[model samples]
Target: MKKLIILILVQVLFTLGFFSISNAQAPKKKQILLIGTFHFNNPGADAVKTDDFDVTTIAAQQELEKITNQIKKFNPNKIFVEWEYYDQKNLDSLYQLYIHNQYESYVEKNFKNKGNYDMYVQNEIFQLAFRAAKKTGLKQVNGMDYPLPMPFDTVMNAIHAAKQDDVMAEISAYTSGMAKEANLKRKTMGLTALIVDLNTEKARKINSGFYIKTLNRAGQTDNFGGAFSVAEWYKRNLYMYSIVQKQIQSSDQRAVILLGSGHVAIIKKFIEDEGLYEVVELKDIMKIK
Candidate 1:
């Protein structure tokens, strides 16, 4: 009995020691600073379009500078933008020009439009991420965007076939109105406040609600199109999260991703679900906490 008792004690000690080493050897989670933003240069291509306010004005430029400075203080090792993943080389080229202070001159000389720096001046990637990258002296802003078929129109057509015009109209009006209201607020609200608001739980829920609740209720039977479309949307976010995870290196302490609010909603959920990284809220960095 004494020998058996001693063996049991020895086993427990070994188990505890093994676990201790395992815990100690585990890598610390890298931090992710996710900033959800409006498309600064609205191309009127989104499902819901708003008249985007200009970021080129002197006052607007100053506000952007303040916001960019806050991002700089995040001290991100990498800055990820929403450009397509396949377009990283092009993005790197543009970023190289911006960092070298020759982006505007190159545009003027090559594009035949001297004053038109819309791509450089009026994009959140150029306005915020590029500026932040330059401040941090990073080599390139990463392009982690991967697009998938959202198929909103097919879902709408299915809803229409199902005689759910009212539901369709309800969803449409609500989303479009939200965009208009945001656009109006942007005209008056400082860019930081607008961005913080865009990343909040309240805002994220509305974006999620479009796929998970509003549209999902619109169809029946063979026309489970809402379910199908939302699935595609979720899949896209999952793939995007995979793209983001692939960019993480063992040496990277933290990275920043500036993406649209709609994408932010699902990817944030992915981060929470996967337990891979510590998320630094945009609000906290901006001191809105």
Candidate 2:
């Protein structure tokens, strides 16, 4: 009887151990969406001149309708955007302020007349986004800093490093040529198509070494301050990643991140560097021709 009992006990332990190992090796499931965008509020002629103005005017009601529909499909519990900390807390106040005037007035009061405010008003991306969030009952979180002018010296250093063997100059020339070509095309074609073509090589050559060098030479002192500001920009963005990670992990639903094309690359970089969260690209949903 004792021998029989020992054999049965050993069998049970082996089965339990096998099952535990299998469960431990199973893949973890995640729900994350990263959507890249053109700055709807950007009123500058950059897009216009570069043939990159797709959807020049963001149709507020139509845009909101699309966003809300996407939300319904994804059912994300959290929504993250490129906004300031204070704005996140008082969305209602922002909504009120945004609706009071067109994009031009908002730009005059807040943006220092840097971007094309008239274009932003016609586009109405910000207002529409705000409205969508309110109507959908989604929680909003800030994702990035304002597009303040960068320091020149630090930028020069990065450029110098990049230019070690004339690499920066060559790349800059290539991108500038492409941007110029796109700009020429914009005069005849629809803005959306031109914008897409321009985007095809945005990161590769758009600003590249030229912008870096310009920033380096802008200031009186080191100019390094703005030059090195990219790191600071990354740090701020990473903080948003940390916050979103915490928020999403605790929730039962998924999360969606809405940001500019520039941010798309960085956010993906952060997720990979952290090795904590799994991120899905929006391109997976849309058919990008």
Candidate 3:
């Protein structure tokens, strides 16, 4: 009877010890910083370089420095950049091709010739980010851009539907609020504002129904253009968010996402909605600082 009592006590102690060890080994959650940047141009300079869409401005440069300082302060474990779904080899190949003026040979043919086409958002952001990331040794830049695998017509139809549903207006208002807070308007605001202003006129037309037949007819022909224009921006942000989440799970490192202002806003909203992450918006932190 004494021996049996001793055995039972030992078994209970072992079970308790196992539970404690399991609890201790559980993985920890990470905090992420989602920062929105304006590419050294003021936040709303969307049409400055119509041919090339250059948005490099004095304010943008200043903003870049500020961003760099913040990243240094945070020192996140990983960094995500706006990129495509290509392997490192393919990415390197693309980079080399662009450098060698051969990017047109295989991918995105005539989409925008580097030589004749003006550098727009991607060019502006990548130049600054690649330089900073290299200098700071934050070498893990992931490309989250998709090649838009649908026909232009299909995309246009989707945009048309989105416009009809007031989705474009919603995006515009969200972007405008951020731009107003920044107090530095540039093409980013211009693009969204254009959409918003047009949609307001549109909403008015629908509500007032002034020449409804003629207006609806005209809208049917010219509709969806504006919506399609902004679709890439919206989709890209979601792609970026997904890639960032994947990176977070793949490694035990916190990530910092440096994307356009429009992207950061939506991504932040989505991340907050997930209720799984502890996200710090640079805007809030800046206010506190």
Candidate 4:
């Protein structure tokens, strides 16, 4: 009876040890660093433009290096950029050439003109995302942009249907004025300061404030322009978040996303809700002094 009892106890211990080992080997939570930035080239394509800011200057390039160093401290295993989803193959091919030290010359030869510089070729994708990936030995950067058609017409039609054209005009005037003032401030403050400011909770709230204000304009009705506006924006961000989710592999325990400042609040909210990732604040990591 003593020997039989000893054998049973050994089996119990083995079972407990096996389960413990399995639990210990479970996949760890992913760490995501979301870096919200202004388009370095000032493409003039966004809803609000910041005037034309040249990033190719010596001073701007030095500031960019500082920013990149701060990002590097995060030690991201993967990088995601705001390129269109359909362009993933092209982005990957570019990244391959980038890692091989052939991308810069290729870009210069193909994209440069005497007076025209293509933001598509030399913007944050190359300055920050590509640089960080190459430094960290990441083979590729994922593109998370969904490029959905904007629902401007839908919103406008709704406004007309509701006879709220005046309301929309007022909202547009107020938002555009505020955006213009902010852009002027950014122009005065310079790049690093603008980037640091934009990544803060305060900046995020400011952006969210504009969104919510517009949303509220839809009134309590179901088919208001505000409702359509809110839905469209939310839908785009949700799709982008889903794409970002797909890029996460078991091996990618750390990832960084580089995107426009406007999208940061929504994306960060999505990530927080997901509970699978810990969002590392750029302000904390960069700690600009």
Candidate 5:
């Protein structure tokens, strides 16, 4: 009886050890944090340049500190920004200056005291991503933007050609409302609240929902411009996400993508579709308004 019991116990131990080894060898999913940030510079480069509020002010700088502190807590392995992917060299070289504490000198030299220098200087890349990277001792901030121009106006052109007056009115209201939301929130709730709103799930859903559902009705029978335009938008975002993927490797356990809020929803969708990464919601890490 003792011999039989000893053999059974040995068999159980072997099975447990095998399972433990398998678990240990299992692949780890990279945790990605997608932070949808408003353009502090408000350069009018994008279709809807949100958040025109001056980030150069002391109050905005203080709020930026809180935002940086929140990102530091995430302790990402890599930090990615919205510059063109091909500009990684230029981006990192500039980041190197920021890291060496020569940011002011570099800015002065590069800008040559140009007008609207404040706009260039106070971009959220400098205020948030660069600051958080230095605080976290990160050596490089990756540029993950793919310069695939989204043909947004094509949908409108199609609608206009089709003479969809009601449709045109609806799109106009949505775009205008987006701009208003930023301005109104900034005035009423301040910078923190504006950012919180920009990063919220409700914000993303509302932004992407139009592209997914309403745009289908944009084009007439001959040309589905609305649907095609939407597909192009997703394609560009997916490519940008791939640029981020190239930067990440097996060793990287976590990463943060600091991008304009417009791009976040589509990339988040791609991340979900892959089912290989765990996304960390920006709102979860942000402080209470």
Candidate 6:
């Protein structure tokens, strides 16, 4: 009996020691910062377009510097932008030009036909992501944007097919009114102020509410306008998350995602659900120093 008891105690001690060692060797948790930003160029391309807010102004540039400084505190090892994944080569070429002080040449060659070069230069991808990558000494920025085949016309066709003209009109008027209100606020409050407001918990919750409402209302008609619209949006974000995930090699990697404010609520939720990352809020980082 005495020998048996000693043997049992020895096994228990060995097991405990092994577990302690294992715990100590476990990898550290990865930190992901999801930064929701207004497009600096103000291209007026989104569903809710704000009046052009120029980031090239001295005051705007100064404010952008402050924002980037705060972001630097996170010390992200990788930076991802909202540009399409397939266009990553173009992004890389642009970054190379940016670093070499050949930005004008790059724009004239690649983007002269797309839109205004000055406006493109001021986009958050260049203004924020490029600067962040440069500041952190990162060699390149990653483009994880995937454009799904959903368009306004496609959704409208579905609605029309279902013969839900009334429903479509009502939703359009409601959304357009909301957009006008938001645009008016942006004009009144200034760009930084508007962005700060949008990054708040209230704004996130509102976005979440809007998403839920869309999902609920989409199934109301048999033609599948609302449902298809919501599904496409959801799929886009999910694929974006998957692309971001692919860039993460180990738990030691820390990433900062620069995307539109509208995407925050959905992407944040997906990150939380993954159980592998700890989402670092910009609000928390802004409070530091």
- Best model per lDDT: 1
* TM-score (all chains, Cα) for each model: 0.86, 0.58, 0.48, 0.81, 0.86, 0.81
The segments of candidate 4 whose C-alpha lies over 4 angstroms from its true place after superposition are: 1-29, 114-117, 219-222
Residue range 67-128, candidate 6, lDDT tens digits: 77877777788899999998999889889888788876767787786767756677889988
What value of lDDT does candidate 6 attain over all alpha carbons? 0.77
Candidates arranged by lDDT, highest first: 1, 5, 4, 6, 2, 3
Model 6 stretches astray by more than 4 angstroms: 1-28, 108-114, 158-166, 219-221
What is candidate 1's CA lDDT for residue 12?
A: 100
Deviation of model 4 at 60, angstroms: 1.7
Candidate 1: Cα lDDT at 289: 72
1-289 in candidate 4: lDDT tens per residue? 9999999999999999999999999877789988898887666767665566667778777877876776677778888888987788999998898989898788788778844456745588887788888777787889989876666666666666777766688668866885787678667876777777788887788786766766446543667667667777888889999988876887777889899888887899998888999888666676755
Per-residue lDDT of model 3, residues 200-235, tens digit only: 323324322322221222224446444444455456
User: Who is ahead in TM-score, 2 or 5?
Assistant: 5
Predicted candidate 2 versus true structure: per-residue lDDT over 1-289, tens digit per residue: 9999999999999999999999999867556666655555454424222433444344434544654565556666666776654455554455555545443466567656545454444342354354445555654534343444434345556557544335345445655775676557656654334324433445524433343444333333533444456555556567666666665655444666766555555666677677755665443433345
TM-score of 4: 0.81
Off by over 4 Å in 1: 1-28, 112-117
Instruction: Evaluate model 3: give its TM-score.
Output: 0.48
Which wins on lDDT, candidate 4 or candidate 6?
A: 4
Which of candidates 3 and 6 is the stronger one according to lDDT?
Answer: 6
Instruction: State how far residue 148 of model 6 sits from its true place (Å).
Output: 1.3
Error of 6 at 6 (Å): 22
Q: Which ten residues in a row have the lowest lDDT in candidate 6?
A: 212-221
Error of 3 at 221 (Å): 18
Q: Where is model 3 poorest over a 10-residue stretch in terms of lDDT?
A: 210-219
